[model samples]
Target: MSQSHTAVTPSVNKVVLAYSGGLDTSAIVPWLRETYDCEVIAFVADVGQGDEELEGIEAKALKSGASACYIVDLKDKFVNELIAPAMQAGCIYEEQYLLGTALARPVIAEAQVQVALEVGADAVCHGCTGKGNDQVRFESTFAALAPHLTVIAPWREWDMRSRQDLLNYLAERNIKTTASATKIYSRDANLWHISHEGGELEDPWNAPTDQVWTLSVSPQQAPDTTEVVDLTFDAGILTHVNGSAMTQTEALVALNSLGAAHGVGRIDIVENRLVGMKSRGCYETPGGAIWYQGLRGLEELVHDRPCQRLRHQLGQQLADVLYDGQWFTPVREALLAAVAVLAQKLTGTVRLGLYKGNITVLGRKSPFTLYSEAFATFEEDEVYQQKDAAGFIRLFSLSSRIRALKQGGLQ
Candidate 1:
């Protein structure tokens, strides 16, 4: 209903859109052309979703009445700029999976805004539903980077009540779409993880059937044998796996392969959406589990307990902020600044053994490690003053002792 309200009418010539070639966006292209009488350009960001999703997308845009379609490959930039820093903070949404959708959105929206500027478009558009988090995500980036450009959200304007309504609207216009309401599931996928929602996933108690997953196989169906891989990090950037150097995209691909075979990551949770809705979704982050654990293990070797605690606390808050589409805010920048300081000496090698539904750290080593085997050994150690602990404990428990004594005297 909010989508029905007219945005401040502005003088506009052309609009650039973040197009996905999905049911919603497929309809949006024609709608924009008809309503505004302006040229429409489609912009798609390739963030490692898949070739199948990208194949023939340009033609689809043109058929839907676009002036031009620009598909930008942002895989390398995604992993290096957005994902790498988030990984360093150990950012995980709801303690389940890495923030895959949360991570990709800002970059995608940024690219769309860039295309708008490049094409000299006065307005931007997206097909995100008014109720969903994505509308907020795309619009927030637009507000931050391109405040002058007006945003056209077609989902808010159109009278399509449901997916069926949208399908019919497209059908009447002779626009082709493969999406169907019978599918019962809406999914978003990238290299980091895949998320599933709708149908039974809408109910909190309904168990997700194996059919919902695509990236990682079910743990029950995973291979019986365990697999081991080595990961090396320098100054918080993941540099190598098994002594082989790789680009960020390549390394994630390699790890995803290993993690998928062993069923290392799968999670179902009811998450708080940015729009004040609680939505139930299943997410699979196989390779991400290994990478997160590997980085955490290395951080343990370098940081003290308090620093690690601070990092984890910051990570939890950052995950929430990132999930809420607040990445453009100063809070996110400050969080990243703190993470950078914490990650300065996070240089290490971590060996992980992947087995059915498990990613275990097999071994860990670091040149800048603060762990000392001698000080930590159970066998009588020279570094620790055992007798001094008696005095320390007495001091630590002094308040408790005084409270008990006073209470007893009062009685």
Candidate 2:
């Protein structure tokens, strides 16, 4: 229930900011320094938002009155540690969202906190708006990892109401900004996906136009020919793509290219935000979608019925935990432990056909597969007896039969 105009006492002499060099964060640098009379250090986490966003980011931070700027490359760690675990656990928030932006927040916050400690800062700051989930995500992380460090959320204290307000504020200070009020969308992107919000997206009834998409072509505009890509997994971790061995980052990058060509990962939904509000967004998660299909196919081949059911339960719990910004908690650790055990036998290969937003599983193979052709075959098999099915059926329905008899047949 935090508002954007809350008053707080300023006690910190230095603070590290989770800077994205965006309109909000750029303005935050000068605001924090002026309001608190404290030295501000910008901390940027390069979790593969792309080179264009990162280009000249340090210089921009410096130009915005930050005493120092630290841009840390976290792509490998992000994929291997955050995205991989979420993928293995089947963590899709609300059964449709990939948690792309949600997953990136913790890693970024952790890095920001690290920079704060290293630089001897008394507090950490972020530009997350009070209405959004990122503010909770960032503050919760700061509380968990570095409880003693003061958390400064400028959006919760500043009087700026909109992007235009921020732009005007910067202009008044003679600070140049790339932001324009005419821009229609607010976006967040990383290695896994890109999410589009605001403008047309804020209206649930509005169908996103071609202009809304950046990562993939429209399904209607996709090529007619289907593309088949082979994915290999080792103990639930993706290891290869199309018969070529690749590192974790390399595999994801490759799959992204293939999935994007087919428009395989665009989703538009009205999701429930953690702050008890509904927000509409369009997400492009091409590589993540393909990777999810491959993992699911492999899981189906290896996991038994009970194990599969339990894994599904774990996945739901994990999704909520990750989405709610409880990453550094014991509940998350326990869920991850359960997922890791279930994923031990999830080694396999999956061949999928991607065509115009559709992913079709062509084939699946696993060394630890429990599928038995003899047991499941429709034809005569030596491993089973037809006569035994009668007893199983009777036993399986015994409770129902007893209940019916006790209640005088069909009553």
- Give me the candidate number with maximum lDDT: 2
Q: Compute the lDDT of residue 289 as modeled in candidate 2.
A: 98
lDDT of 2: 0.90
Q: What is the TM-score of each candidate against the true structure?
A: 0.95, 0.98
Residue 177 Cα positional deviation in candidate 2, in Å, after optimal superposition = 0.7
Candidate 2 lDDT tens digits, 1-411 = 112435767688999998999999999998887788899999999999999999999999999999999999999999999999888988888889999999898899898888998999999998888888888888889999999999888877877888888888888888888888899998999999999998877778889988999999888999999899999999999999999999989999998889898999899999999999999999999999999988999989999899998888998898888788889899999999999999999898999999999999999999999999999999989999989999999999999999888887843
- Cα deviation of 367 in candidate 1 (Å)? 1.1
- Candidate 1 TM-score, C-alpha based: 0.95
Predicted structure with the largest TM-score when compared to the true one = 2
Steric overlap count per candidate: 0, 0
Off by over 4 Å in 1: 1-10, 409-411
